[model samples]
Target: MLSRTYSRRVDRVQAAVDALELPPAVYRTCPFEPRELVETGLRQWLRCCGAAMLDRQVIGMPSFAVDEAWHGLILCTERYAAFCRRAYGRFLHHHPQGGELAGSARRAGSMAEQLRRTAVAWSFVARPGEECVLWDLDVRVGVPEPWGAGTRP
Candidate 1:
């Protein structure tokens, strides 16, 4: 099973991205599963088959790029994303507690390196050609109430 605390981390990260309000032009989504990250392989594979998407050739030809608004949203939070997606499957929730952690720290390390290098794409999806910032929940929840209800409790 997965630990509730570990799962909570993913939820928190997701909420932050939802709040960032990124511009529409800079991000997008690709029509492929995270597991199907064969960007270069797919291109080469297609050439061998002598097929294309214009005529509905392959069973799953990429119709769009992950650079799209919604896709970018998902791509932007790639840090906890792989874990989150696998955890939620159909929806977002805390992970069950039991299964041992998989994946390597090297991936997380790479993401950290990218984050230090950039603040926008800086957070997740290091391989991304383009990226934007996801909000920081730690700061979000601290924001004061509306002007009408101003003043600390």
Candidate 2:
């Protein structure tokens, strides 16, 4: 079972993912499953999602882990990144401290770097025999836009 705080984080991430309207894709490679099987499974999943699925080519590798119960997924998109920035700014507003904006700027830079590195990355928790729960979902915007660059609105 996930802690309350973790659960809240998952809820927030899920809300963000939902807002993106990118069809969900489950990527997992079991120890017992062959690579071919994993690929086939992912393809099948995407097919099931139909038009809702984001272009596989654009999404790149959907699975970020193998044999691990927990996983992390980072969806990189300009809109999503803006959403994260707004969300983070709101968070900072509610909980403020000196030099917080500087720290946030540094983190934003790091996030941008990661976004440039991958189309989508995954970071979540999935315990065996239980549903996978998101612990941290990082959004990397492809191109840095001027909108939502500063503090919260």
Candidate 3:
């Protein structure tokens, strides 16, 4: 069952994501078709992150397009910081794939393992009728060369 706080944070995160406008340059860098679907996927992932904030879990990015969308959001420092405060009460840090801390236990997982955790986090926070496309968002959105190959749905 979802705690009231977690539910509220998820709602706020979704709203923040909805309000964001990813610039065209972002798409130019990580091209994908059916922009709406990719955007929706990104929103859902962020909501999952918000929900999992207290758990201190690592939610991996399973799609190149969604990752790009996140990159765009992060570039908007003020808006992203404000949105993070509203959604999770703290800034959600992004650790690039190869930049894990030297001995940090939290960063000690393979990409596949991280993606599996992401799926599990989504299971806990997904809305009643919500369906996650993140597992295969790259291929679904026709990313030229999808990033995630071993991700489990």
Worst 10 residues of 2 by lDDT: 133-142
Error of 2 at 94 (Å): 27
Which one wins by lDDT: 1 or 2?
A: 1
**Could you tell which candidate, 1 or 3, scores higher by TM-score?**
3
For lDDT, the strongest prediction is 3
Model 3: clashing residue pairs?
none
For candidate 2, give the lDDT of residue 100. Answer: 45
lDDT of 2 by residue, 1-153 (tens): 547764555445444434543222222312323433433323322222221121121112223221111121122244434544432222111112233455554443443343232222222322235321111111121112221123111
Report the C-alpha lDDT of model 3 over 48-144, residue by residue, as the tens digit. Answer: 7876676787777888888888887787788778878877778988888666677653564776777778888888767789888887788887877
What lDDT is reached at residue 133 by model 2? 15
Q: What's the lDDT for all of these models?
A: 0.29, 0.28, 0.76
Per residue, candidate 1 scores C-alpha lDDT tens digits across 1-153 of 436753454444444433434343223333333322323322222221121111112221111232122344444465335433443332222111232146433323342333232232122222336322122211222223211111111
Tell me how far the alpha carbon of residue 91 in candidate 3 is from the true structure, in angstroms, after superposition: 0.7
How good is model 2 by TM-score? Answer: 0.25
lDDT pick, better of 2 and 3: 3
RMSD of each: 19.6, 16.2, 2.3
